[model samples]
Target: MKELKAFLKSKDVSKSEIFKALKISYDEGLILQYLCQLFFGSIPNISILNLLQGLFKDKEEFSYLDHLKDIRHLMELGLVKTGYSMLQDQNKESLFSLLHMDISLSEYFLQFLENKKPLDLSINVAYENHLEYLKDEFERIKLYTRLSFNPQNLDFKKDIQAYEAHIKKRLAKSKFYNVLAEIFKENKLSKKEQIIFIALLKEEYSLKNEESSSRELNSLLALVSENELEKLKNRALLDENSKLIEKNLIDYDEFSNHFYLSESILQRIVNFKRLDKDKQLRLENALKDQEIFELIEPNTDINDVIMPAKTKELLENILKQQDKKVLERLSLWGIKNSKEVEAKIIFYGPAGTGKTMSALSMAKSMKKVVLSFDCSKILSKWVGESEQNVRKIFDTYKEIAQNCKQSPILLLNEADQFLSTRVESGASADKMHNQMQNIFLEQIEKFSGVIIATTNFLESLDSAFSRRFEYKIEFKKPNFKERFLIWQKALPKNAEFSEDFKLDDLAQYELSGAQIFMVVKNTALKVAVSKDGIFSMQDFRESIEKELSSSFDKSKIVGF
Candidate 1:
């Protein structure tokens, strides 16, 4: 207060002007104090009634004239200057003219207050629901700004009236109004694009918990032109080549005509921006109707497995090789000109042959979390929705990778579901399946994260998908020697084997390692339940017979 007064007095202003300036400084101090409260605390909103009550508290004895003078000064010197700065601060006044003050001013205040300069206290939005707080502030702004809407000048008056009416009629009722307000301030959406975007929101609001909320281009034909739709498509690419309309708020699949908000922006909208990775994921999962991917908690140390010597050597080489140096050396040696820093590994083979186990081992050795998923879970019955789910799964992993210190491995089990050969059939369902493959093709080309995909039917997979896997190691059924080792590891030492039961004979069944372990466990369980807990060769034989017979029976049922 003294500094402002001294500076004003140094200018040698008139007596009345000095009085006004001094009064203005006093009023500005009060306003600054209120703003400081907003900026320095987790409380995102302050209501008009509460603010006014605090301002005029214990002042009933004061005349109305004095109260009016304070109000006038606060408006003239505080909010007026704040609003002007928000609108003109970027030197893009024309862009601001396209914006409504209700959103622009509030967003500016939020972004400005995020700065740590000269604030009196530390503010944390951790415990409270930030979205709700933003909504309350938005409501306050709407109410306050409406009081000054002018009806005199036709040009300015018509624009303000129409803007207010549009917001009220379209966005006011939305629970996402505050988030949309911030998004609008950040992005440059044309009127039509904004309308279509809002319509997408409205569509999402109408869906049931399990229903797909993806939108198609045809659905927006009535709202926007083809040119605008195409622009939206190009901007959604996961490359630097694409031009973003709103700092990448939404992701669009050009092939399937599907589009949705990006997960990061969605988290920001919900005020989950500052949360730790695990908490953010948990909150996101709780909000979702379905889980996008399965998260695996693997052992901290890599597990040893008995596999083919060639396969073992290949995998060991990959584990031992430094991925960063390999990429750097390739660029330095002029072998390739690329910026990709990821290792795309693939392990495809029969079940129980160590594909999944190898993937877990590789991730553990790298000290990275394994984000595994069964592709069947992501496939939806609705048209175009399955492709959208693929994008979501990839995008979700990308977000997780960004927050993690070590890049995580995205292990896709049963990759055949989306990686299979595309049929050239004329049916739309077939085409949709092909579209899912196409989406992955594009996404995988630009993928910048480590991925490990496994499949049972490697021969059935599309050549294009197979070609993208940098480390394509085929997992085979363990032979007699490997099976012998696996059996030795799986069997309990306390279990007694019959004198006639030979461990060498057990490896000759051509069963996978998983089947061998299951046979031994089942034999022990049956013997323990019926007899003296497995001292006979008959127990092991019966269990093996049943297991082998089930596969034969299934084959018989299928007329194989």
Candidate 2:
């Protein structure tokens, strides 16, 4: 008490107990002395205008610039604390607005300044849980947010270094920081990218928002973006080419202009406690009971089929989504809204054509399982059941998708009757058919996965249905060229052929690819049992005649 009295009575400000507690300069100490006197004399806190008035009472010693500089200096020293009413002002950057800010000695300093006691400024501020860390870190991040708008942001880098150091100090105790640091290390994120990730995480945990809009994300990103152009550059980090998105660490909803954590990363990084099931296992369990879909693992791909050049090109384009650059371009062009590729396609042509085969093959090309639903099964003998059956198709698909990570291709085969035009009729059957079509149309419009429905002819499709397809592929009955190729492909490699057998003669038969396949199989059987053991044109020709003949004779069973 005697040492303090000597210091207070002396002119040396450094020896004052208040200066020793705050560890501030002589000029800052002088500023704090007046603030402390006014704080208890009138109120616990002082208005910015009054604080200014009291601090610069001797105007000749300090200029107005010195007053403004001193105020910022006090703020920098953490001596003067400003309330939200000042920070929340949109025009807080203006001089008139700064005067409205209410200021006070920090609560930490107030105790010591009033008691004339030494202040202990040391304590472990590290948070114990992820939520607490997010809460504290979120507030700290807002300081940078305000700094972004302030022109007096000369100490920006210093502030950032301190924030980083604080985070590093807490990393050992903060699971959020540890997990996020691991992600950053794995993805090799730059300093700016790390800032963006932390801000997004703050938005997620602190705000309890799963997604942030582009505008909201941009403002949060202003910590790194110094100007409009730099902001554009920061925006590019969320674009299609972004490593954050390309690495599957982030997800974007293009339709909503929102960015969120990807599922693959969210479960690993976030501390949310929602119980989630293993969807792959759930899908496996559910698949055991379903009878409507014939699950197929196709042995063929798009390359294995012989189709029209135009058809081949279109299918190739659909498969192009597998390419990263192609997928990125798709999202950039707004052709795709999600990261995954989606298709609603129609394969319409003759019965013997390759519609069903192509659909299955396309699935194989994309490495997806096929859920082939015979459209005939959708029709029920019971009335009003067809619409329910149609609904069941989509409902079952959703269940499978939700229960599985990789969605299967939904292939609706032989859908001629379903795709037929809806009649404006009052009859029960017509009403039922129309209602079923409406349900089908609605599902098709909203469906975001691969769905290919095949009918015999595109002309059979209602215009409404036709418009819903991203691809309208027609499969013409194989002409001589395609049939020739099919014949070459279908020829049994293990079989022997007679010297006189000619492929041109077989290709000349105006037979569809299916007929040619049957011709080869039947001919191979006939030749296998022959004494000569050779595949001859005569053997194939006889099979062709038998296959082409529609009529069946009961007596033919005795032909052997």
In terms of lDDT, which candidate is strongest?
2
Q: What is the C-alpha lDDT of each candidate?
A: 0.56, 0.68
* Candidate 1: segments with Cα more than 4 A from true spot: 1-289, 300-303, 323-331, 334-341, 552-560
Number of backbone-clashing residue pairs for each candidate, in the order shown: 0, 0
* Tens-place lDDT digits, model 2, residues 238-339: 777888877767776655545676676777766433224565466666666666777677889899999989889989988778666777788899887665
Residue 280 shift from truth in candidate 2, angstroms: 8.6
For candidate 2, give the lDDT of residue 23.
Answer: 51
The worst-scoring run of ten residues by lDDT in candidate 1 lies at 99-108
Model 2 stretches astray by more than 4 angstroms:
1-290, 402-405, 551-560
Cα miss at 276, model 2 (Å)?
A: 17
Say what the RMSD of model 1 is.
21.6
User: What does the lDDT read for residue 183 in candidate 2?
Assistant: 70
RMSD of each: 21.6, 14.6
Give Cα distance to truth, residue 24, candidate 1, Å. 80
